[model samples]
Target: MSLFLGLDIGTSAVKAIIIDAEDREQASAVAPLSIDHPHPLWSEQHPDAWWAASAAVLDRLAADHPKLMSGVAALGLSGQMLGVALIDAAGRPIRPAPLWNDSRAGAECAELDVKVADFAGIAGARPMPGFSAPKILWLSRHEPEALKRTRCILLTKDYVRLCLTGEAISDRADSSATLLMDTQAGTWSPQLAEACGISTGLLPELVESGEVGGTLRPELARRFGLRSNLPIAGGAGDNMAGAIGAGVVRTGDAYISLGTSGVYFVANDRFVPARGQGMHTHRHAVPGLFGQHGCVLSAASALNWVAGILGVVSIERFLAEIEAADLPPADIPVFSPYLGGERTPHDDPLATATLSNLRGAAGPLHIGRGVIEGVAFAIADCHDALIAAGASIGTIALVGGGARSRFWGQLIATVIDRPLLLPPLALLGPALGAARLARQASGGGLSHEGDRHGMTMLEPRAGWRPGLEERRAIYRQHYAKLPV
Candidate 1:
């Protein structure tokens, strides 16, 4: 009678859920999180806000389902990777955490490229402005006072873990993306930390994803109506944990996540840094496994932005109307999906999204279609980048809020020129993946393996290829000329 609770501290929100031993979800809750963009290329959030949201969500879960909450044998966490939360000696955040998509560290990234030898091969990524290490350097130069008080630097989910357990720790899966880890060794790199103007002492202790990080504190347990001293499993980064939720455990397994941020993830049995290809090489929650992924800063966020502009209340409804109208693809303008800059294939934080080739004949529907097409094309760029970096691809499972729209999923499939699989209950991916880690921590078998059911296979529709190829060419040309 084991129950596992998993929580994801995402950029947009915190999603928490509880699952029984049989892997069926018993209860779930979501609490929205807002990001502050005080300046261009800046994304920050207070660490206390994250804990407040998770605490409220968990307390609600306990209030609603006391039985399920009591049965929880262990808990797990998953979250956005590459975010840096600096905690003082009193376990208080010294300042707002810099988010993964924050690009203020571009100059710092350049300095690292010149500082670290074989930078890409060593870091398992190019010195991108969005990674945690560069951001720490940015803080060192821009906000030295905060760094002086910092006792530990934690990734997003690890920040939550510190709150729940009163321990400073992180797992390989999340820490690997911090650019302070030697990806192959699966350990923190003092050299990298020194380069970032920090010491390894500031990092959370590294653990395997399924390993027990710390027990739940008594006060938290009483508030959440769970057993005191319940072990907390070390959870992976959202994308890596999400790969688990999507059943992408084995080598060559792949999936696409279209959330606030879009991710193209592929599993590998061992570390294979696809450096300079704009992909992240990260540890999988599964032991001895690794994942390579590319990210687009905007995906459903881009779609939702257009929907808001068009005054559409329901996304599914709007997409339905677009599909019903059968809008001619060529009539749509080309859109660049870089609303918050880009990572995969571009790695350019200064890049801006664009909508070009607009004509008076183009209506809202046309603009909507173009936005959708542009996102799909950008994801395809992620796919192409990975392939050129020497990773193989096949059918990909779609995982995220976007999976609900067949219109969006099918369009992405057509753009990638590969079949896509949409798993049932796709939106629960990262949190569910965290729950799966909890299950593992509780001594259960790897239950997520090979249990594919109720998944829809999407194929590339024939009619879209030719017109999209021409459109994609224009989109690429637009990118070639874009920086503003």
Candidate 2:
């Protein structure tokens, strides 16, 4: 049986998985990665570190699962979006790459808004500090020398792809989020590049997500113990890959991803920009489709913070406590999951989290429940934005690390008041999606039968409606009063 490999260069780690022709996972591995914060509101990682991590994970998979590695037909990549890696003509990174969570370019964002008239209409989203364009502007002002030497600009995964294939190319799905791409046209915008004080020649060539980027370079392939002619798909950004992995290919198909960050992604058949409301309209991994998303800067990360504060040694234990508490609506505290600031609806990077109505008796359990509810409320805010934009949302597929908890799933269902579908392999959303893309690039057709199997559905409990409604009202009131 032919095998496909998928690699995800995520914010917290680099993960790799091998799947057979039937979409059954044969082996998977992950290597942890670190972020640098040299100054306040800054998040950067070395492009070399990403390549090292990717190589390490692939090395482990090849060592332990030789048979799986030997039959690998193709590889696909997915990674965090909006991060920029400046590479010189020699393909070496000139400086550290700013990440998606980086917020040091606030001033540059305003500059772009002024420099590029009709910014939202052209770029398909409002200028935000997390995007590549602002980061480039920041470099232009602060690190002009590095910007001067920069010959090619690549996103996170595309940098790794360069190492593997000796090519500098990115997919339309990832390019659309850069604030430098004409999303509707599925190409880079030279006009936007000029406005950002950068030359258009620096952007990587764009391709469809499932198209072949190139074959693995012979030397790298031999060094990594892989086939020489292995094809690499022009993969996607994390959220778009997650949507593809969840079979959210058609219009109206939506998925809620609760990774380190939260994303509510809806597939649309046509280009629909929601820039005014701080929502995003990005190209989808699937051809000819677009993805509309509302992103929360922190989702499961908020839960992780609560776990640390509560001194819970294991996430399992923390989740157990949440499942057991079952706090009634009136007793639950209200929380805002803005630990990393916010994106959708409110584009404030300085927004701090708030916990309200904490009684003298309130403890970790109440706070935990509140944190979960807060994330749900944030997603509901996004849901409302999509609805306001005239997008229809039906059953939502809930995927990611936080979706592992039955209680959390049910809570989100009640908060959003929508039926939720949980694929058995939901946690592997991006990697699996990347593998599927790899399969397609190799001229293989994947059967949707496997995707439709082993699914669990969670419906909002009627009993929880009253409590959810009451808490939602309080949440909205507090959210409005938050210091922006």
Candidate 3:
């Protein structure tokens, strides 16, 4: 059977999924990786660790199914976005990659925002510390030696693609996150690059998502027990891949992703910068299209913080407790999910998470449930922005760790006033999406019909009030009063 490999490099782990030409899953493997935080708000990872994880997972898949490696038509890559992976002249990472969560470059992002205010018609988004440009500037100013020797700055997937194919290239979806690309033009912007202190030499060549890059090297293929000359497709951003996995490819399609960060993405037919409309714009995985995406920087990370603070005795026990809590009918405490900062609406890195009502009755369970609700509310805010910006959402596909909980999914439906669609294979979200893309790119006979056999629809229960209306008012007042 012909198979395609879809490797997703996330912040916590590297996942490899093997899918047949029909987009059916053959096998999957996951290998965990570690991130280093040398300082506060600084996340870095060794590129070697990623490579090792990828190889390990590939080996595991090959061992499980001997024929899984044969006739591998195409390979697709997906990864956590906004990380800056600098390589020297030999196409090797000089140091650990500074990750998307790194916030040391807040000032640089602020400077870039001011510099590009007038020319924002092309970039389609404001600069933020979580982007590649600020991260690059931080490295250049702090680590002058590394900056001087840097030959190219690659996003996470771009770096991985380089290991597979000798070519140094980046996809437009990931390139849009760099703040240096003119997203509308689908080309690198010299003006923005110069403002960010980045030269064209340090940038990787940009390519479309489905376009072919290069063939796999013989040595790497042999190492993984795969045949040489496998094709590499221009993969996509992690969110985009997740969206695809959730079957969000059509216009007006919506998907809510609760990975490390949370995003509410709506697909559009053409490039529309809802720039001043509060949502950020990025090149979609589907070529010649764009996405209106709203991000909450510390969505799942806020839950992680709660888990850490309350001992890790049993995650199941904690989840059960929160799941059984008495949910409010109309109004609830204002729960701000911004632990590190926020991305959408305000884009403030200094914003802090705050629970408006902590009185004598609140406990860890309340806080936990509130965190989920808070993230949902943040997503609801984004939904409102998309609506105001003329995006008529048709469906809501919820995929992420939070989707595993019935309470959270239902609450999202009520809060956003849309039914939440949870496919049975939600856990395999991004991997399945990348697998589908890989199959299509390789001329695989994957059925594109809307089977949705594994999908579950979560409708709002009766008497589920629109808590978002009150929450929206409170959020606006709170944000207006924020001391930025």
lDDT tens per residue, model 2, 347-465: 88887888897877688888888998899999888888888877777658999988888788898888888889998889898998899899988998633566656789999988988
Residue-pair clashes per candidate: 0, 0, 1
Q: What is the Å distance of residue 11 in model 2 from its true position?
A: 0.4
For all predicted structures, in order, the TM-scores are 0.98, 0.97, 0.92
Tens-digit lDDT track of model 3 for 4-50: 88899888889999877656777889999888989887889988787
lDDT of 3 at 314: 63
For residue 195, give model 2's deviation from the true position in Å: 0.7
Q: Predictions ranked by TM-score, top down?
A: 1, 2, 3
**Candidate 3 worst ten-residue window by lDDT:** 444-453
What TM-score would candidate 2 get against the native? 0.97
Compared with the true structure, the alpha-carbon lDDT of candidate 2 equals 0.87
lDDT of each: 0.87, 0.87, 0.77
Q: For candidate 2, what's the RMSD?
A: 1.4
Q: In model 3, state the lDDT of residue 64.
A: 80
TM-score-better candidate, 2 vs 3: 2
- The weakest ten consecutive residues by lDDT in model 1 span 445-454
